[model samples]
Target chain A: MDVVKTPQQAAVTVEPPPGEPVPAIELVKIAKTFSSRRGIVTAVDAIDLVIGEGEFFSLLGPSGCGKTTTLRMIGGFEEPTEGQILLYGDDVVGVPPNHRDVNMVFQSYALFPHMSVFENVAFGLRRKAVSKAETKARVGDMLDLVQLDGKSDRRPRELSGGQQQRVALARALVNRPRALLLDEPLAALDLKLRQAMQLELKRIQREVGITFVFVTHDQNEALTMSDRLVVMNAGRIEQLGSPREVYEHPRTRFVAGFIGTSNLITGRVRAMDGSTALLEAAADECLVVPEAASAGAGVGRDLDVTVRPEKIVISEDRPGSGRCAIRGRVAEVVYLGTSTQYAVATAGGTELSVFVQNASDADDIAGRGADVWLSWRPDHSLALVTTQPAPAESRSDLSGGNQ
Target chain B: MSRSRLGARLTPYLLVLPGWLWLVVFFVVPTFVMLSVSTQTGDIVSGFQQTFHWRTYVDGWNQYHTQFIRSIVYGLITTLLCLVIAYPVAYWIAFRGGAHKSSLLFLILLPFFVSFVIRTQSWNFILSDNGMLLSALKNWGLVSQDFHILATAPAVIGGLTYNFLPFMVLPIYVGLERLDPALLEAAADLYGSKTATFRKVVLPLSMPGVFAGVLLTFVPAAADYVNAAILGGARTTMIGNVIQTEYFTNLDYPKASALSFILMAALLLGVFAYARVLGTEDVLDVAAR
Candidate 1:
């Protein structure tokens, strides 16, 4: 069977129907700083990002990472300090949010409280001077699209959170903007509703095929909804890639730790050749790291290595050749239905976690306090340049080799 | 289990008891007394023996014809005028005041720091004949030197509007302040122009505040004897002045009570009628919020 490209993977080259061929929206070196009595604070640092025609891209980061600020800049709600925002390739710098061809679904779902659902959806069409008959038909169609045909006369406050969210979605989509910017659209929902709405949002995006630039702090949400995600930290793009690529081959320690659970090891370069490098682990043990780049360290320059817990094998006996092995006492054991996780403590007083899935009728690995060997192939380990110390202090001790 | 059930059942009513008591003591009892006195033919001082003379309403009506109607009309005009002026100011404060919002709100409320009497008296100085304002208007070719505003119906209306403007401003400001800005931006993204966004989204959503403000300004303005007594000529008399006269000068307590009851009934009926037209129950709920 031939694989079809998802909206995230598909190139956003096709123009939206019924419009002049132009770039949907563009921002060049956008920067925004807020100055108050408290002092000047740079909310959105000098940044550049392009949202193309009919694309579903996402900016993923924690709060205060400037993702929402970037979206606000594109929507013309906030004027860029030193950059230009272009809609359809035209500099939209003094154009108000109303004039911009973009819309946003706020996290709180800001439906007009006094207007009925129908009136709310028809607001944009009426503004555009569309005929009354056409407005009725268009608004009716949008209501049906959002599965709210029977609720046209109902006020927003009367609706449930999920229903209000759908009404907000229909209201924005009825206008048929060039792009839809969703700022944590599902944040207000409970877990179950949020999960359901994620799929619903994906389906809606597929059906509409409009450019969607979503902003979210949730890594799981971004991974599920986005075709490609830009993981951001401290007002800079840390990495941008497909979910699997970014998850498996994270280029930075932040990306590795931010995306999913991983075991980290800090070591110093002992020796290096063209293909592989030997490193002295923090536990006074030597490790052979494969596919490792030369650190140009003579003997004691420190380096960091990241290995996933699932990649390590915990057994009474060492498994295979060219695998880094460590002897440790099992500190704790947690059986998680499908997988068994063991926290093993090495002689260096660092605790390392090893997870192995239950694939066969083998007895469970050792209990807490049992001595064992933790092993993983050198190819599965990564030797990284030791840059700044761990950005998060909680993960610092865990990064020192065996821990 | 019995204790738990009793607590659960009584807690809600207990929580609501204070407000209910307040309403009964301050509102319901006064309205009942007014109703009784309105139906009495004789004055309250002369034992009225529970005599039900409904003609008192008619007499009250006939005695104050254009003045009663004029008071209501002037109140309506002042309320409408305040709404027109306040919506934009409230919108600016609510949606665009950025960081200095508390200070801006304080400024809007600053006039209330002085007593209403003081505020009304201040207007006297400003709008007095040959006052600085009159001189400025004459200098600017807007009014003649002989033309004055302190004794006219327009002066009373102006006084009423100025006195009650803060009342109108507060509710509208509250409504506008509570508005979720993203909703406006959402409307804009849906292809609404600034005017359209305001008209369709911001205006309708803020109507609850408008409704409350209208009620606050118009009801007080309609019943206000102070502004009319201070700034109005005999031609600018309102129903409140009539009631005051009947109570004090004429010593006809029953007739004054009858007039007060009639005004209160009219206000209630008007509010109900407005709610029906605008489908404003939800707006009122939001206003309360």
Candidate 2:
């Protein structure tokens, strides 16, 4: 899919067929800015997103990357400086959160401390004036779903962190809103508990079939849970695609670096070999970027590319022909049980990371300071754009950031 | 290492020595002295003797039962008034005061810089008939020349409310101030209206503060005679005024001590009942934490 979708494309997505499924939430040209002591800071540059019904979507980004702000705008907790947030089909910018058909799970869990788990879960239903019997049955069912049925009478403080998180989930899901917005719900959990809750949350989402808009800075969390995820940076989306697509085919330098470890290389197109552009880097190093990724590059234009560590194979001898190969010496080696990571330093002062699966309990092919060859398929080389050609300094900064 | 362990064991007691000594010398001794005086029979001309006159309590109650009830009634009214007046002020300072929250809190405490009696005396001056405030109000037709506030029950209650207002504001402010803003957002996200959020989440969470403020303000306001002396007359005489009169004017030390003990007992009983009615142990646990 094309990254940075155009306004025309976004407009085309607004109206679905009469019988077709509609988007659960549509953020159209949403922009938020805040004036602080420093100055006017743009939190979320105008962006468009259409999250489908029952889709587990994530806005993944680092801190201060406008992911939480976007979720807040969708939940109606915050007013956008510009743009319209549509819940299902109705515009809900001026509507208060109480009037919106959405619920949020705060990062802090935010369960009412003074209330029992039953009362906390029953809060939304009570607000909606749900019949007492129905509210009890529904809250009871939700507590069961989250496996907190027996602890309904207990206060939030009495529960463990993971249990409290389940209570928070039950509280939001009890209302059965059109969409559930979760802001780093499991960020507070330990590694084991967090992984467990991730699957648990996914299972609950599937069982309830509610659209889940999860905001998280953890790339692994987003990749593992989201049906589709948007990678945001500096107030705009760098890319949006499935875990495989975003991981294997990141579209920008920021996305490539932010997702996971990637070997960044900047070079000028020395020549075009049919569908591949031969790139020449510092110290006469040669690499080939595919024509599909570096389409704008001619014989002399500059290009940037990234290759994932797992894609590059490290060998004791030079790799065979038909693959891009570079001679380097092993700089460092880290033995992970499943896979071993090797940092290969080329003569051009480029340190390319290569992760080779430890297929057997044998010694690694190359040890530290051993001469080795790193090679990857040309198709795996992803050309990156700083921002669709914005400015000179930023382009320089992009190259500066690659190393 | 053994010596260090011994020092560590004694550290807590050593640290507590000053406070323990202060309480014993000031509070414990005076309480024992008052207890003894309460059971003695006395006359101003012929000095008091330890005759175990426990009947003085019954006589004191019989003579001043009206004042005791009035004092409690005034205390309840003043507590309710303070809660009503302080909750919003505390809420405003907590949620809306923004950058000026500390300054606003400082403003609430500013009047406390003046002596308590001086403040009550100022209220006396302001509420006095044909005084500066009454004359000004009369000139503006806000009140008639026949209007009066001094030497009335309401003036005394009003004085009590104003004097103890900060005691109510500070604790409630602390409770509301410590409230997590995310909880409010969560409440809103759960589809709660503004009023419902305030009623359910904000009010219940701040109950600890209200309970604390009540404890802090009610006892002192109940035992206060300055407001009664300055802003009240015959009908408004509380147990505090009666105790003062028996202690200083009537020269009946036995009756004064006995009445003081009765007032303390009544206030204690009232507090225990209030705590039982307003708070369960669970709520108290949260409030205490």
> What tens digits encode model 1's per-residue C-alpha lDDT throughout A180-266?
888888888899998998889898989888889899888888888887778776555777887777777666777777787777776
Tens-digit lDDT track of model 2 for A1-403: 1112234324433466799777888889999877665546677778999999999999999887788889988888778999988777667777778777788999999999999999999999998888899999999999999999799999899999999999999999999888999999999999999999999999999999999999999999999999999999767788999999999998888899999998888777888877678887534334888863344667787887799999998777767778887889999999988989999998767788988888866565888999877888878888777556534433222211100
Best by DockQ: 2
Residue clash pairs of candidate 2: none
lDDT of 1: 0.77
Total clashes in model 1, counting residue pairs 3 or more apart in sequence or in different chains: 2
Docking class of 1: medium
Which candidate tops TM-score?
Answer: 2
DockQ, structure candidate 2: 0.85
**lDDT, residue B245, candidate 1:** 93
Model 1, which residues run further than 4 Å from truth?
A: A1-28, A36-38, A48-55, A84-95, A129-154, A158-160, A173-178, A281-286, A294-299, A360-362, A385-403, B1-51, B125-146, B285-289
